[model samples]
Target: MSNMLLTVEQAAEELKVHPKTVLRYIREGRLQATRIGKAYRIDRAKLDAFAGVASGRTRPPHGVRATVIVEIPALTTEAAERMATFLGAAALGGDAETRPLHFNTAFDPTSGDLKIVLVAAPSDAARLLELIELQLGLSR
Candidate 1:
């Protein structure tokens, strides 16, 4: 069966639980998902497996994906743009076998809040974090 992507609300409805519960499942590593901006998309096969349905597809090993969220309050717009640009460039130069990298940056100039979400292979995640640390003078 072709896998369909479901939103958190949809998955929660299917499981008869609140949307937050699905988010918890994702956070606890009980379910697999692809982070899109501030939202998550769950594969139908994974949802079926989580619900104890036979999907005829084996689940991939845990920790196959690495998700990193970084928040910077009071960050200047210039700084946010610089960080995003640097991270985007770094994210684009990975091996083809590496999982596609997702780098999302949300900035609110009014509040000077910057939130960055990155999802990719573990190595790629680490590298991106290093870039971020270096960019923000957090290297140690």
Candidate 2:
């Protein structure tokens, strides 16, 4: 079989689903694709993998237990700015744009630390914690 890459629309057509459904699959981690800049190019094999044509199941590699949301309060303007940059970088690095994820920041004068909330897959919670530690200079 030719290992041709397909767009979301094409994949949706083949799967008899809507483009949004394909997007949802990508967001939910039920499908995998190659990121070409801002676009996702999925190969035929990957599409088959997602459809369970080969695997017989469309579940994530592991079960997701819960979603984690973290809050950090910013005490200083400098810290807040730094945290914002770090969060953006981390999101990009984590490919969160194509995954089930939400990242946001807020300020609280009453608290002394930067506040960030990350709602993500349970498997990624540990990575989020590691990012928090790195942000707090607690981990290298």
Q: Provide the TM-score for each candidate, comma-separated.
A: 0.53, 0.46
lDDT per residue, candidate 1, 34-123, as tens digits?
999999999886676556554554445674878899898888889888877776667645432344677688999999999999887788
Backbone Cα, N, C clashes tallied per candidate? 0, 6
Question: How far is 12's C-alpha from truth in model 1 (Å)?
Answer: 33
lDDT score for residue 13 of model 2: 94
TM-score for candidate 2, please give it: 0.46
- Per residue, candidate 2 scores C-alpha lDDT tens digits across 1-140 of 53789999999999999999998877655577788888888888767645535333355676455555666654587787777666655554443123444567776655766567776666566787897787788896
CA RMSD of all predictions: 9.8, 7.8
Q: Which ranges of candidate 2 are over 4 A from the true structure?
A: 1-65, 95-98
| Top model number, TM-score | 1
Give the runs in model 1 whose Cα sits over 4 Å from its true position.
Answer: 1-63
